[model samples]
Target: MHKRLFIPGPVEVREDILKKMSTPMIGHRSKDASKLQKSISGKMKKLMYTDNEILLSTSSGSGLMEGAIRSCTVKRAAVFSIGAFGDRWYKMAVCNGVQADKISSEPGQPTLPEMVDKTLATGKYDLITITHNETATGVMNPVEEIAEVMKKYPDVVYCLDAVSSLGGTKIEVDKLGVDICITSSQKCLGLPPGLSICSISQKALDAAKKVEFRGLYFDLLELYEYIKKKDYQYPSTPSLSHMFALDYQLDRIFEEGLENRFERHRKMAEYVRQWAKERFALFADERYASNTVTAVKNTRNIDVSELNKKLGEVGYVISNGYGQLKDITFRIAHMADTTLDEIKGLIESIDKIIM
Candidate 1:
C-alpha cells in the first residue's frame, strides 16, 4: 500500500499535477523553453509577492540557500537558528569557508527580533539568514517583526529559508525586504523534488559582483545573468520535467486562490493544534507554532517507530521528531495540498491507535 505522506516535503501530489510531469522533452535553449520558463517566472512573481528577479535552480532549496550566502556575503554572515535547518545553513557557511557566526534560540523557540537587532548593532556582518518555518521543531519565525528590525540594517543582505513555508504561508518578499527568499518544489508548492526557486533583489546581485569564489554551479550572479542574457534559460540543462509539473501546479494553486490556499493550510494547522492540545502537548510555543507542521511533545512516551509502522500499514504516515527530538516529540505536517478533512481523518486514526 502506498502510504499517504503527512510528513514534511514531497507532500502528496495531486494526480493531475503528477501527469503534468510527463510532458515531452524540449530543447533547453529553444524559444519554446523560454516561453515555458517565462510563464513560470511570471506566475512565481505573483505567488511570492515580489518584483525581484526570479531565479530557478535544479537542486533542493539548500542549493539557493548556499548560493545566497556564498554569493552575497562579502564581509561576514550572522546565521540564526531555531532548529535543524538553521544549523544546516551555518554548516553550509562553514564548509564553504564563508565567514559566519551562528547564534541560536532554545529548541522550540523562535528567533527573536531583539536578538537580530543586537547582532546587527555590532556592525560586523553584512548578510543574515533566518529560517521562516523550521520543520524540525515546528517553529515559524516572526518574519514580520524581524523585517522591521532588518530595516535598520539596510546594507545587510537578508536571506530567508522559506523551504517549508513559502507557498503555504503568506510571506510578502518585497515588503519583508528579503534580498533572497528560498523555497523548494516538494513542500508547500506540492510538486516533486529537484527544483528550487528564489526571489533575488538587485541589492543582493550587486553584492555578489564584489565577492570572489562564489562557485559556479550555485552562483547566483551567473544564474541571474544567464536568465537575463539568454532569455530565462539556465546556465546548465535544467530539470524540464519538474518545471513542467510546477507550471501546472502553480496554475492550480492560483485557481484555488492564494488566500484560499493559505486559509486551508491555516484551518488544517488549527485542527491539528487543537487535537494535540487535547491529547499530547505541543513542542513549540503556541504563539510561534508552524502552520505547515506541528511537533507534538511525547508526553505519553508512545513508541513512535511502532506507531509509524501501524500507521504505515493503514496507509498513513507522519514524521518522528527530527534530530534529538526524535521520540521526545513527533511531527504532523499539514502543508501543500493536504486538506482539512484529511487532517481530521489522520488525527482520528491516531486517536484510535492510541486509545
Candidate 2:
C-alpha cells in the first residue's frame, strides 16, 4: 500500500498539480516559457508579500541559502540557530570563507529579539540569517519580533530561511526588512522536489557586487541580472516542469484566499498540538511552536521505528526525529495540501495502535 506522507517535504501533491507537471515540454527561450516564468514569479510575490525580485533556482532550498550567504555578506554574518537548518547556515558561511558567528538557543527556546539587537548593535556584522521554522526542534522563531529589532540596523542585510513555513504561513518579506528570503517547492508549495525560490532585495544585489567570487550557477548577481535583462527566463535551462506545477498551484492557493490557507495550517497545527499534549509532550516551546510541523518528545521512549512500521501498514507515514533526535523524538508535518480531516484521520490511526 502507498502511504500518505505527513513528513516535512514532498508532501502529498494533489492529482491536478501532478498533471500540471506533465505539461508538454517547451523551449526554455521561447515566449511560452517566459510567460509561464513571469506568471509564476508574479504569483510568488503575492505569496511572499514582497515587491522585491524573486529568483527561482533549479536546486533545493539549501542551494538558495548557500547562494545568498555566499553571494552577499560583505562584512560579517550573525547566524542564529534554533535547529538544524540554522546550523547549516553557519556551516555555509564558514565553508565559503565568510566572517560569521554562530549563536544558538536551547533546543526548544526561541531566539529572542533582544539577542538580535544586542548582537547587531556592535556593528560587528552586516548580514544576518535566521530560520523562520526549524523542523528538528519544531520551533518557529519569533521573526515578527525579530524584525522589530532589525529596524534599528538599516544597513544590515536580513535573510530568512522559510523553506517550510513560506506557503503555510504569511511572511511579509518587504515589511519584515528581509534582504533575502528563501524557500523551496517541495515543502509547503505542494509540489515535487526540484525547484526553489527566493526574494532578493536590491541591497543584497548591491552587496554581491562587493564580493569578488560570488560563484557561478547559483550566483545571486548573475542570476538576477540575467533574469532582468532577458525578461523572466534565467541564465539556466530551468526546470520547466516544476514551473508549470508551481504556476497552477499558486492559482489554487490564491483562490483559497491566502488568509484562509494560513488559517487552515494554524488549525491543523493546533489540533496536532492539543492531541500531542494529551499523550506525548511537544518538544518545542508552546509559544514558539511551528504551524507546519510538530516535534513530540519521546515521553514513553517507545520504539519509533516499530510505531512507524505499524503506521505504514495503515497507509500513513510520519517522519522520525531529525539528526540527533532520531528515535528519541518524532515529527508530524501538517503542511502543503494536507487538511484537518486528513490530520484527524492520521492521529486517529496512531491512537488506535498506541492507545
Instruction: Kindly list the per-residue Cα lDDT of model 2 for residues 175-199, writing each as its tens digit.
Output: 9999999999998889999999999
Residue 348, candidate 1: alpha-carbon lDDT: 85
lDDT, residue 267, candidate 1? 95
Once superposed on the true structure, which residue ranges of model 1 sit more than 4 Å away at CA?
none
Local distance difference test values of all predictions, in order: 0.94, 0.93
Worst 10 residues of 2 by lDDT: 298-307
True-vs-predicted CA distance for residue 96, candidate 1, Å: 0.8
The per-candidate count of clashes, in order, stands at 0, 0
lDDT of 1 by residue, 43-141 (tens): 999999999989999999999999999999999999999989999999999999999999999999999999999999999999999999999999999
